[model samples]
Target chain A: MAAATESFTDQAIEVAGLKVRVMQGGRGSPVVVLHHSTGGPGWIPLFERLSAQHTVVAPDMPGYGQSERPEWAREPRDLAILMNAAIDRLGLTGVTLVGLGFGGFVAAEMATMNPSRLKALVLVGAPGLQPEEGEIADQMMVDYEDYVKAGFRDEAAYTAVFGETAAQDIKTLWDFSREMTARLTWKPYMFNRRLAPLLKEVRTPTLIVWGEKDAVVPPACGRQYKRALPNARLEVVAGAGHLVELEEADRVAKLIAAHAAQA
Target chain B: MFIGYFTERPYQDPSSGYFGATGRDLTDLGMSNASYDPRLGAELYNRYLDEKVYAEEMGFDGLMLNEHHSTPFCMGGVMNVEAAILARITKKAKIVLLGNVLPIWDDPLWLAEELAEIDMISRGRLVTGWVRGTGRESVAHNAQPPFNWERFQEAHDFVVAAWTRPGPFRWEGEHYNYRYVNPWSRPYQQPHPPIWIPGVMSRNTVAWAAKHRYPYVMLATELEPTRQSYQYYDDQAKENGYESGTQNRGYLFKVHVDETEELAEAAARKYIQGPSNPFLEGNQGNVRPFIQNLPGLTSRTNLLPTVQSFALAASRGRLKEHEAATGKKAEAATASADKQDAADFLGTFTDQINKMSIITGTPKTVIPKVRHVLEYLRPGSIFFWDGDGAMTHEDSMRSLRLMGEEVIPAVREMGKSLDLSSPFEVDPRTNQPVA
Candidate 1:
């Protein structure tokens, strides 16, 4: 068993014959963090908070960050299968999966594939289910910067994380991440039509977290997730956007921790 | 030389305030369909078609058409439909499509049938061309951007195989899958019509064209860089175990000739005035970088010379807008020296004329400039881009007449002297001196 640590370290682990870049820290019961379409936020404050009590493993979801891209992987389901393989290879048991936005879709898919493998699932501003109200915001229609900024509650929150102007390296990474997202989620524009029915079978205890002011993924998606999952409750974070985890890290982490512990 | 007449078939309406001098500097893709007046569209479409028929009568070897989507800059969103019209309307002129946007089509088999029918209708006067298309096409058509190149290659292969090969073969490619690949309409041209590839700054496309020994047509790029681009094609061809010649190269440039130089200049200036095109410099000058450069559409590393020049200009345009809004110069660090050079290069209309990017004059004056280009690039095919950017039908007719009467004869003599033979005259694939 890995010892509980304050800081995270990156390790290149092989899963499904592809090099997956995993950022791991802390140790106890396992919790894997799946990232959004703009790739993993890389041990953000939310992950750091969770790392205090849980073995947090955040891999850069293949074809994103430093992870090797598999040409065969097209949709979120393909990524879910690879992530399941990754969990199996890491020897994780009674895992509590945390997915943010697009990552939530992958986590939900993982839970559906093997409900017994997961102890709890936390979906933050996730967009797997189609909202009954407004649609999931089309990322392709707007500028990349605008799309990223749309995730935050306001400019201050965005500036705090990404500074005044994103560095060229960050821009490059965002472009790469967007390309991967486009590849996987272009046709349906985020949600799978079958995901709602698939989620009905995911019996894992679930927490559907959403930002009250989310402009990217509709807040109604949280309710949709709750309705889809048999044993799930919706928690809306006030004064936050789609990236609720980044905006209100402590609150989200507390909710996730409580859910994981209870499960 | 294969002298072809081309136009974008612009949907021009001056009253809409979407085009011309003093119009809003709207981005190319941002132009709304609300501005499109179908009454004007009806008049313009037929007028353009009439001009094409006249071009054949005036001695053009080919009538060229191109496609763009969701923009008023080009009304040929479904250009193959126009090609089908030309196949029936015109005689003794190759109905050249430069060309169908391959990546946008969900099924290339439909396109194969469409083109094959056009070829059969025209009795083998179809010079088929394919373009990977720009970011606008991908977005407007809802085509996958990351898989654009892959889809383009697959679609091209599928279309060619459908045309040449016998029916009912299975095609199991990544982007496209078919249980049975069969189309009743085979192309009229033996082994399918000649495939020509046109591009702006994509080196991958240029290399691909060279590898396949397809005629690589440089579209209104600057003279020096265009020569270098053709040289790159030549080098690629040599590496691919073949010697490239004039037949393997083509150049399309804006050339408007009038009875007088002043009239020609006035008409030529309209090229930048009508329906703001992001691709055209000194026009709208508002190229949304995100829209133009969709993620993974074109590789950043393998860019040609013009891309840097264009990028610099686009960035400078953005900086100018920033300054106008904020009342302050942007950070000096962002204003790199390359951008300064591009700012100077994308200068006034006179500067463009001096650069030979836009050649306009009386036939006698324009012929010498045309001679200079022919001598420099040695292209076997030349497309005179006329009647576009809000140019009146009368303006286009005059230019076409002058080109056919004076320019074409002179250029043909120049081609003879330069030993330039078009792809039709000398087959690009077999490297036959005269077909």
Candidate 2:
């Protein structure tokens, strides 16, 4: 894998009258990244690696990160609509949509709504489908630090990404992001009951990825996503947790690159 | 002065293993009703109702009731039901609901109708109040936390409109919408019953209450901070073009009176013995920070002084320390010490008394403490929080008798000297000295 040395620039774009903070870089095909419930993790190693081959455009979902909050938006589907409008404003075509965790739910909704606009759909440790055996871990049950740590497989992995303790500003951002998540996804938790049926309608090529030890959303959710989408494949990354993209950025980026190339 | 009586109406089942040395130290949100006995619930509810009746006989001007959900700390989850009962059961004492959790109600029109009926049944003796409920209420009722304040404001408006306006009015709101808001029952009180607001923190609530000229009741907050909170209310009232007075302020605190100081102290110590509630100081169990301070429930930037104090105490691990101490005390008392001593270790009783958080003594000592509170805060209305935690029927009766016989008369004289007049006496609307 090439070194993740690609630099990205932050841009504020207006979508549906809401200011969306978008981080874009690199060249060639467009890969729009949707962030987790705790908002965007900035231009991380995964985005950098992806940007090396493709134009990686990561926008903080409305009400997350630097994006303007829409008080009227009350569900993942609402965010998905806003994101689709954002994609249209960015003038992107044949896009590879990559969603992480809560972002995955939004991505799936967007795909179900407009499958023809995307060349590929990638869901990483997402939680839009109700697991048949286990349940999605409730983020509101613990403190912000504990919830973030739960995303990683170990303390080392957590420290590597978020440091020993997050700064006060970062903690504040996490809290703000969680409030948005609570506003959008408090009921039925992170999953939409109608999503499973809607997923069966989407004909877009999809790649469902899960960590082997993903504790936040069960690995079985990956299999469910695979079964729901007609043209989808599942990949499990070993020794990773919910945040498989961050923990194994090189490997996941390689898989995405390979998948996007085929699409 | 409007003297009222209040209690958490705790579900004190000693067999539930939630009370005592050998019990599971359960937190407020963590408590499950799996061990709840309907038989005990029935008895406790009736007993509490009986006590309220006795309170009316004991000459309390009003009976204050509050609502909390999914917890044993307060059995009045649907406190309106108690208010409705009190309206019919008691003749003179105002049925004060302070208050219904506004944001939790999906339909405020229904709440309006309920209150209207209560007012009519009580011959217009109703003091309706509203609250922006805690995270527990939001979680229990599945109400959106981010829209709590909005929903509360909207709900209050809707209920008031429903009560005062003509029938068949179309209502469309951000949080609620109704095609027809006409209820057959209107409030017996002209222009509707007086609205009051009770709060511990949340500066926004205090300011809002002041703007509306509703009596802002400080619920057992520290004396100094309570004074400061009242000052904030006064400042807000001045900004809104009114000079606020004692009629616009109220205070509720734990005050237990008995024949002797020792007996009063023993019964008062039961305040921290039973199931833990985050609102109650010196609780045995720890509140989950995430659950207690749910995102968007209350803005962090808009907090009162006591919230910072609570945060500081939480950061210092005071709750954990209290739990550990209580656990050890329970273990040590297993062989010899009585049940009272075992539970007495739950909190520093002396500290609470010294801090004036909990006042306990015979009428003479307790009356002086009450006078001190009146002099310090000068609230027009006062509610003595009694018969809570694990205090028995006899213990509650003794306190009520002592309060009626001695403490209340002394407090009334003190109220006169302090120039305190309740909202009922002085119209909150016109800021008149007397209505």
> In terms of DockQ, which candidate is strongest?
2
Indicate the worst ten consecutive residues by lDDT in candidate 2 chain B.
B322-331
Residues forming the 10-long window of minimal summed lDDT in candidate 2 chain A: A1-10
Candidate 2 lands at a TM-score of 0.93
lDDT of 2 by residue, B134-247 (tens): 788998998878889999999998998998888889998888999987899999987999999999778899999999999999988878778989999999999999999999
Which whole-number lDDT from 0 to 100 does residue B210 have in model 2?
95
Question: Model 1 chain A — which ten-residue stretch has the worst lDDT?
Answer: A1-10
Off by over 4 Å in 2: A1-6, B307-309, B312-347, B433-435
lDDT of 1 by residue, B36-148 (tens): 78899999899999999999998999999999998888889999999999999887899889989999999888999999999999999999999988778999998988888
What is every candidate's alpha-carbon RMSD to the true fold?
Answer: 4.3, 6.1
